[model samples]
Target: MIDPILPFSSYSEEINSMLPETIQKELVFLIDSDFMDWKKIESILKKFPSISHSIVRRRLDVDFGRLSRRLTGKSIGVALSGGGAKGFAHLGLLKCFEENEIPVDMISGTSAGAIMGGLFAMGLDSSDILPLIRNFWLDRNLLGDFTFPFVSLVRGKRYSQAIHEFFKDRSIETLPIPFYAIACNLTKAERKVFDRGLLWKAVRSSTSIPGIFPPFAERGELFVDGGLLDNLPGSILKERGAGILISVDLGGGGQIDKDEMYHNLLGPHYLGEAPSFFNLLFHHLKRKL
Candidate 1:
């Protein structure tokens, strides 16, 4: 029986292998956007500006037989947390899940977590996505340092554009698994689960870190990274009736204090002047931070 959650009729080779084929590249079914010549939801909305929400829902509804079968009596949910570069570590954790044959019936994530989680839900295995991450992140042309001073320097255009390109051909409904990308509406001071709209847009919004990246705009509304409010959305998954909720938190501070620190550089209300040389050195380090 064919799993119908995804349009497998449209699947092509997602991973290719030459030797040690079984362990290296397995046949993974995924929907091909180019094969379908899919148009972005944004483009479709523009073409039919007056289209009703119900119509949009109808158009976005995908056949979910496969996913339904997997979730027959289970309510498994996986929630990925926000942790900039630490997401790679989270990816490793996901790889562990795969090795253990754990089923992620539904998924939600924020920031880098959202990006990786989205890819996994779209039928890309960790092996398939590892190369994409390496190529994109290691490309000097894409991540090179910027020129000009007096600004944040990382204006985030390159990364933001990359995000758009990745999802230019897909929508949320096409995900191979149940998916949700979490973002925040600054104006509303709340977390938003983007279960609709363009997949790339949701990913973009989920990664729009406050100072590091610009906000995402949709129909003139502004959205920033969901990490700003709810990074590990276990509550959201629980609210959705998740039977087994697995949350991967990157520990907001990303550090566990060892109870071994006993020094305050500039003591609690210090008014003393340090040596000129030491002050200059500390100031230099401060600027770097």
Candidate 2:
């Protein structure tokens, strides 16, 4: 019941400190940046055989590569490589776990790593704050003069209202800019899929579907909320099978209330380019178990 975040190297030590000694030997998984050597990871795993360990390295590079490729058509094929390159690493780890029949005790991290961990828990894609903001700006052009400044200010604010205010101020400053990606409701099918827990798994698998325009709608209930789908192309929404699209604010923010439609923002602190948040998040997940 310790709520430690994951991905930092010291996570193991922290978990050891927090948990009862008898339960300290449980298996753990640490997914983080590709800085640590596999040997080191092996050594750590060996130290706690009862606690198997794994890492998904090069996480950000993978996401950035995917995003960059999407933004710039030149790298489309590479970018579309599902969850970016890091996703492949994650899959490889998952494959290993599957082959070995290893059960993940916990997963954690900030930003992408945190997102994946959250997805593992909630069975959905954790909202990417930067992408959400970028998409918002792309659709509205409201943050023309305030993009960077607004991001800086909002990074520290974790409360839902504070984030709403930030968006409101940006809207007021920009004028006539509509919020394009806010979900007002979940379709009946979407609600049913979400209730069944198939929505998130579909999204994760859909990433691997081949095609220049992979049908997101056909992929089942996307883990996005109604607003996100609204912003997406019409064709994409129509093809959905059972994927649930949770509200942007709810998913991005770490608020864990399953009943609430909204959640806090993930904040810039977690999204900053610095590697610390990633490391910290991963560390927290690996050791906490």
Please list all clashing residue pairs in model 1, or write none if there are none: none
Compared with the true structure, all predictions reach lDDT values of: 0.61, 0.27
- Find the candidate with the highest TM-score and give its number: 1
Candidate 1 Cα lDDT to native = 0.61
Please report, as a residue range, the 10-residue window in candidate 2 with the lowest summed lDDT.
171-180
Deviation of model 2 at 57, angstroms:
31
What are the models' TM-scores? 0.64, 0.19
Candidate 2 Cα misplacement greater than 4 A, ranges? 1-88, 123-289
Q: What's the C-alpha lDDT at position 134 in model 1?
A: 83
Model 1 agreement with the true structure over 125-147: per-residue lDDT tens digits: 78988888887677535444354
Best by lDDT: 1
Clash count for candidate 1 is 0
